[model samples]
Target: MTRSELLNDLEQSLTRLVDGMLVDKGRSIEFLTRLDRLDDIAIDMARGINADARLAGFFADNTPWLLDEDLTTAQKGRAGTLFAEITDLLAARTDEEGLKLGREAEEWSRAMGGRPLRLVLRATREEASLSDRFHALLRREAEEVNMLLAEREHLMTCLDDVLSSAELKRDRMHHHLAASLIYFLKMEGYKVEPYVRRLRRITEILEKEKPC
Candidate 1:
């Protein structure tokens, strides 16, 4: 495909992924909760900006300054002008209304702590975490897949023998096999939690929506 076509295809895939995620009620609720948190954060930021009277920007009521300690009088005056502009924008609304929104936002922030936008976006958009060591470890383990498979086969054989032996009880053998399976999967760089989660979700849905 052409470069533009390839980019379009990737965008389509991402759109489908997002759509599927939103289709689930739980996931949609989770997204809405995040948005609410973002709103609260934005409001808190606006309050801070109004209170500081320095470090002006386009959206003067959105975010705060980097260095609050060393703002010049001139900078503060500039910030005052920006605040005046913001006040003009909110002129139709009473100060009481603005204060109410601020109080509500503060309460909401208390209810659900602060999260910077960058961190939130990183959490939602990224697949792999930003840990080089984790990526390296995953890569190393993946490279040893064949060796891990061999080790797993050996363990399975031993587990079979243990289960069949007269001296071993069924429960003991099952426990040993479970431990071995866990170890083997870890060694092979396979994440079993997602599969377990899928099974649990299926079981929960089935139980809740079973035929009456």
Candidate 2:
């Protein structure tokens, strides 16, 4: 594959894997394994790009930044790459398989600009506390949702102690984007009661976990 083509494939794979994590717990292992396979040296040499090194940079970045309209075309690609890199690093931990989850995430990001949904609070990108706060508040809530899903899925898969710190961080990001997206729609007065209910269930689940 050409360099650009390889990059495109990488993006799609990363996007898919990340997307899978957000929506489908059953398939997460498959996505992660794909990510690990793509980490191979032969693939990089064939494409003339060091996939491992390129993906390493992704681990240090945040997923929401990928959606910032202010990012240059190049910057968006970099952010996407970083997002994928992080996914790859994370997926390496378990039943091991991994890509293709990005389109839905992008759609939600566009929802910020009133795409398919009105905005009560439009999310804008700037280097400021307000920008950070918008995502931060929703992200914390999102993390709760992720924890619930992760726990339930772990029970279903019977996978134990498979998560690393890096894995948890990646998991948080996926939940944030998904939760923040729903919260954004809620801000618009959209019909997000289902999401709100699903999110609130996290609290009840946690309550059950506390020492009695």
Candidate 3:
């Protein structure tokens, strides 16, 4: 594969690994503990890249500063750009919308003097987090995957408690957060989920979501 192809493959592999880590936190820790496997894969990829004579020749022929022993401005720019690309890929943040929000937030921060502007931006971010993470679950899994009917009912009751609370419903972001929290509980299987508090603390944090 070409260098771009190799990098794209690595990015896809990393993104899938991150998704697996998010979905299975318990096993993810075990996977993380076995860092040697990751090291081996990275080393193998590096060796494969090094073995690509044409890939090296392409870089040598195109890059004027390739043979420079001293780090030039071009080298610094390339390094910074590559680092940013890797960061964006790993974070799954390819959209310009988040950057647009940030630029707007910066302008508002200058106008409003920091704290107040931050509250508004926080609200915006929380609102933007409305993507339903549990939407992709198979219908049969939700019905029959290692969960009893009673446990499912228990989860439903918990969700009801969140929705039924006047306190949670007072603020839209809090309401959304409560729904998300419950969705996660259900997704993780109701039998193994933790107890829900009155959510007073979360609401208190949600206090910041109220832009002055």
How high is the lDDT of residue 179 in model 1? Answer: 43
Q: Write the per-residue lDDT of candidate 3 for residues 7-107, one digit (tens) a residue.
A: 99999999999998676555333322322222222223323332223322323442443233343333233222222222222233345643443343233
- Model 1 CA deviation exceeding 4 Å by range: 1-94, 115-212
Clashes of each: 0, 17, 0
Residue range 1-212, candidate 2, lDDT tens digits: 99999999999999999987776554344334333333332224223453544343333342343344544333233223323333333333343222222232233234332112111354554444355444443533333234335445532121112222113332333334445555666677767675556444544544555558
Segments in model 2 whose C-alpha atoms lie over 4 Å from true places: 1-80, 83-170, 203-212
In candidate 3, how many Å is residue 49 off? 59
> Whole-model Cα lDDT per candidate?
0.38, 0.39, 0.38
**What's the lDDT of the predicted structure labeled candidate 1?**
0.38
Model 1, 22-114: lDDT tens digits are 665453344334323332333334334342222122224433331243333333332332233333223344577565444443333332322
Highest-TM-score candidate: 2
Over all chains combined, what TM-score does candidate 2 have? Answer: 0.25
TM-score of each model, paired residue for residue: 0.18, 0.25, 0.17
Quality of model 2 by C-alpha lDDT: 0.39
Residue 176 local lDDT, model 1: 37
